[model samples]
Target: MTETVKLKNITIVLNQPRYPENIGAAVRAMRNMGIDRLIVVDPRDYDLEKIRKMATHGCLDTVAAIQRQTDLKAALESFHYVIGTTARLGGQRRTGKPDATAEKIVSISQENQVAVVFGREDRGLSNEELRLCHELVHIPTAEFSSLNLAQAVMIMCYELFNACVPSKPAFTPRMAQRRELDAMLDQLRDILIRISYINPENPDYWMHHLRQFFTRIQARAREVSIIRGLIRQVDWYAEKRYRDGRRDERNRIMGKGAAECD
Candidate 1:
């Protein structure tokens, strides 16, 4: 018997969804693809009845088990890996094809909780929300390019499901959760700003590059802790140098005043 691909660790997250019907249909698609976990963040209207109607009786369990949160960041705190879906591409909105992205997801899912986040039906994930995702997956479409919310979810889920089979599992270490990585980045940003390494006015612009570097390396939890420790040491050294300089300046001024009195 072929070992069934287990997707219990993968979750579907809808960020600021506007319609109950779309949520329902997304849940139906998830169930069909054997993905049971669903999280909805700040939905405009969460009409469970309407969602259930679209999901039909078959996916009632998926709808019933939906997790609701007001904040997208908080909803993603515990996840080890996050993949955001995008329709528009340019600037920092780099995207990977669904099939290739699914292979990476499968590798990471072996040892971590992966969340595939989809944005609102009208507009996709905001730039701020996309920063939280380690990777972005885009479904290729015709020039028209606008895809229904449920349709996007189904295509992504299908690619993930298909990629699971015939792919041997590789050992991927448990990566740092979003919360841990965010904390480390916060400290890093503050230190970089204090040292004039990054512009204080818009620290996130430079920090985005750092975020990409860390994501590419797939930093582990212990590595995050080490980076935070290094930040603390840099903070201490910078403070010490400033204090020493201030003391030396004061002493020189006092000596000059004494010579003038003489």
Candidate 2:
């Protein structure tokens, strides 16, 4: 049986785009690739005539997408995975060969809304900026590795479109939502602290250890939720016992005072 996939919620996020024409071309490219959603963050000009003219039919609804964002980090937090397009190398290359990345995306294609991010024309995504992505994708290129903004989008979209559909169904892995992952992380920390395996006061040391451990496991969404539930139960009992002990100590002090007065 052939597994079906549709591009219902794929988003193209342009971060700090400098050229109006580039934005227009990107929109056009997305329209060609069957991508519907476009998110422009902190672009130079929202009302550029050059971009509007180039965008044509696709520009109608998407022209208003040009938005000013104070926090790009928060904006990306909800996405299941982020794919950054870059012609430049070194700091921005987050690994995975072109075919490998395409395979990875195929596996996690419909898990959540995927964001294909493009950085400014002059300089690509910063190291800190690229860190938000779950995996890094590089368009296979010659030594020169320079592609126009719209061309980059076209390449990524083509690969994505191709990757989403396969003759033999790929084994898709379920992933934890960002919120669920966050909760699991909190629970993990609390459980360790409660057990005195991790000192709450000097959390940095234990936090590093915990991060390394969890990184190895690569917990899925359902697995994370189940583990969190177990931790919550442990915390509930620990808290109840602690309160009861405090109450007992108070009663004992009061009873001794009453006897001494008598």
Candidate 3:
């Protein structure tokens, strides 16, 4: 008997959703697809009664268990992997198909908490929010690409459900959580700025590429620690060299003064 994907480890995050009905319907869709965890961040309008009406009594448990947050970063801090759903694609908004993305999610879900984030109904995830995601899933459509919030959730959830198969054994360990990665990135940014590797005025521009590289590798906790350690060593060495140079200059100046006095 093959093991199935860990659906319990998967969470659906709705970012700045505007309608309670859509939230309720999204809850129903999640329940149908066997994904129970739901997190709502900075909702524009949230009414329990209105949500429950659309979710129906059958999905009361899911609606009741929904977690609410005021910040997207805080909501995603504990998750090891995050996938953002988007319809528009260009430039930095590169995306993967739902099926392929689902496979990757299934593998990562084995040992990490995974989150699938959806943006507001009017406009999808902003560039800043999308930056938080390790990957993006785009549901293909005709030239007309607009999709309802609930509909997009249902489709992604269905793909995840369908891909719940025993993935091939790989080194998919408990990867570093979002918070850990963010901390490392912050440290790295400061060090890079000190060394003039990245522009202080626009450090994030270069840091974004480094973040993408780390995300692509699915860095583990130990790996992140090692990177941080390397960064600290670099910082220490740079400081030490500067101090040594200053000391040598002072000695040279003092020696010249003594020679003149003699």
Query: TM-score winner among the candidates?
Result: 3
Location of the lowest summed lDDT over 10 successive residues in candidate 1 = 1-10
Preferred candidate (lDDT higher): 1 or 2: 1
Off by over 4 Å in 3: 1-3, 166-168
TM-score comparison, 2 vs 3, better candidate: 3
How many Å off is the CA of 185 in candidate 1?
Answer: 1.4
1-262 per-residue lDDT for model 1 (tens digits): 2223358999999999999999999999998998999999999999999999999999898888899999999999999999999988889788999999887676788789999999988888999999999999889887888789999999989888887535355668999999999999999999999999999999999999999989878999999999999999999999999999999999999999999999
Model 2: per-residue Cα lDDT over 1-262, one tens digit each: 4443446546788888788888888888877777767777888776668878878865657666654565566666666666776655574254655555655566566565667788888897876676555556667777786788788887777666666456586654556654565567777787888789887898655675455455334457778779888888988898999999999999999999999999
Per-residue lDDT of model 3, residues 1-262, tens digit only: 3445579999999999999999999999999999989999999999999999999999999999999999999999999999999888788777999999887676778899999999989888888888899999999998887789999999999998988555354547999999999899999999999999899999989998898998888999999999999999999999999999999999999999999999
Clashes of 1: 0
> Which of the two candidates, 1 or 3, achieves a greater lDDT against the reference?
3
Regarding TM-score, does 1 or 2 come out ahead?
A: 1
Q: Of 2 and 3, which scores higher on lDDT?
A: 3
Best first by TM-score, ranked: 3, 1, 2
Model 2, position 20: C-alpha lDDT score:
81
Please identify model 1 stretches exceeding 4 Å from their true place. 1-5, 165-168
